[model samples]
Target: MATKLGKQTYQPDNPPFIISTGTVAGPFEGQGPLKDYFDHVYTDTLAGERSFENAEKEMMANACFTCLQKVNVTPQEVDFYLAGDLLNQIISAGFCALELNIPFLGIYGACSTSAEGLALAAMLVDGGFAKLVLASTSSHNSSAERQYRYPTEYGVHRKPTAQWTVTGAGAALVAGYGAGPRITTFTVGKVVDQGIKDPMNLGAAMAPAAAATMVQHFADTGRGPEYYDLIVTGDLGKFGRELAVITCASKGGFDLSKNYNDCGLMIYDTEKQDVHAGASGCASSALVVYGYLYRKMLAGELKKILLVATGALHSVTSFQQGASIPAIAHAVSIEME
Candidate 1:
């Protein structure tokens, strides 16, 4: 049975294992520093598909397929498929699930969908309700921009705080026992609204939520910043990463300056890439956690890691209605055992 801790955290008695992972990156991401970490990189955003939306779905399906292929696990062997995306109605996840033909559980956590799915998948396996589960998420730059902000053809001037949506997908398979990292703890965050209404500044809106969850995770697990080899936030870019470090020190007295980093900052070379703030989207942390970090863990460089993926939960309708962005962060503690 999973043990609840400090109101929002859960420590699984039999921690679930992340057996395999798959990641696919887009052209722009292919030029990034961690480009070699990805299993596949698309030549173009379309990926031979007619529309960006279709291409996003293809990427997600391919990611899931890659995971299964690596472990020789058939789709029917997986008990459930948990996935989500930044698309309207989570169309990309839905289409990917349809292709996989697994029992599907669609989730929506904005950019935090990756961690959210992992947490739920771990819970199901830890509870003995599932033998194997697949968690996947994806985002496409052109498709997300058209739905959330502006169409690519418009070429609207972006603010300095605006982040580039990552065009990619990632998937991981969780099992009751496996030869990989173990998911020991999960911290679920509350929806926090800081009264910020600007849709472009997502990192600013999400930093508070990320801080709250990190604080709670530390308190619940009786651990501090020094517990993990590395602590990473999902898409808090250069500016928001600084804000998160300051907020953690002020609120929880936790100094994260030494071993902490953000996926948004690590995913792209902000100096070289045209991305203003950095990378943002479901695939931002997904690609880093499943590709780069996973490979490092396998090489015995990093034994433990804490991934806190944050999300700005606001829709086009809510933004237009002058509603503030409500953000959340889900934390997953993975350690090699």
Candidate 2:
């Protein structure tokens, strides 16, 4: 059963465990700091596929397959599979689900899809409705760029605040009983719009939402910054991470100086990669959490951590209509015992 801690948070009595994970990275990400941590890395963005969209589907499918193979669980034995991506109608996830042939639930939270899927999977397992659930998400730089912004063929000049969409996918298998990090709590965030209308400045649009969710998680669980070994945000990049720290202190009076970091900053070398702000996409936090952080927890490096995955909820149509970006963040607390 799941206990309602407050309006925005829930605590599961029989916490679900993340038994296994698989992360697949593209060439650019393979060249980053955590290159050696990823389960699989492709040499190119196309990945030997006909199009970038097909390549994304391939990556997502490979991630799920790797996750299942690691635990020796077949697709037929899985209870449910939840996934999402940045493509139109979540085509990447839809196609991958079709291939898996498992009971599927497609979700969309932009880049927050990773945490959102995990949260829902935890609830289903804790409620005894499911024995095993797989949560996953994917994003491609070329696919996202052509849909959300300018096409890569145009060679458009990117702004200093712009972030690079990660070209990768990540998947994790969650079960009711397992020898791995347990998902203890989850915090759902509200849609927050700070009136920032720049499509290029995703960090500025999402910072307030990340702060709101993080502060609420602390309040609901009756814990402070010292409770967790690490506090990480999804894809806030460098600018939004700084803004999130300042916003948390000013609004909630909670200082996040000691143990806070952003997945975007950890995924790439901002100086050498020419990534202006940092990485942003469904895979930004997904790869780091499923690949690096999860392994670190297993190795006894980190006991507890809070993952806050943030997303900007604006479509190309909305941006073209002069609408401001509305962002949201979802938090999940994972602990190893």
Residue 176's C-alpha lDDT in candidate 1?
98
The alpha-carbon RMSD values of the candidates against the true structure, listed in the order shown, are 0.7, 0.6
TM-score for candidate 2, please give it.
0.99
lDDT of 2 by residue, 26-140 (tens): 9999999999999999998999999999999999999999999999999999999999999989999999999999999999999999999999999999999999999999999
Residue-wise C-alpha lDDT for candidate 1, range 112-212, written one tens digit per residue? 99999999999999998999999999999999989998779896788899999999999999999879999989999999998989988888999999999
Instruction: Give the Å shift of residue 200 in candidate 2.
Output: 0.6
In model 1, the clashing pairs are none
Clashes of each: 0, 0
Give the poorly placed runs of model 1, Cα more than 4 Å off: none
Largest lDDT belongs to which candidate? 2
Lowest lDDT block of 10, candidate 1: 149-158
Q: Which stretches of candidate 2 lie above 4 Å from their native place?
A: none
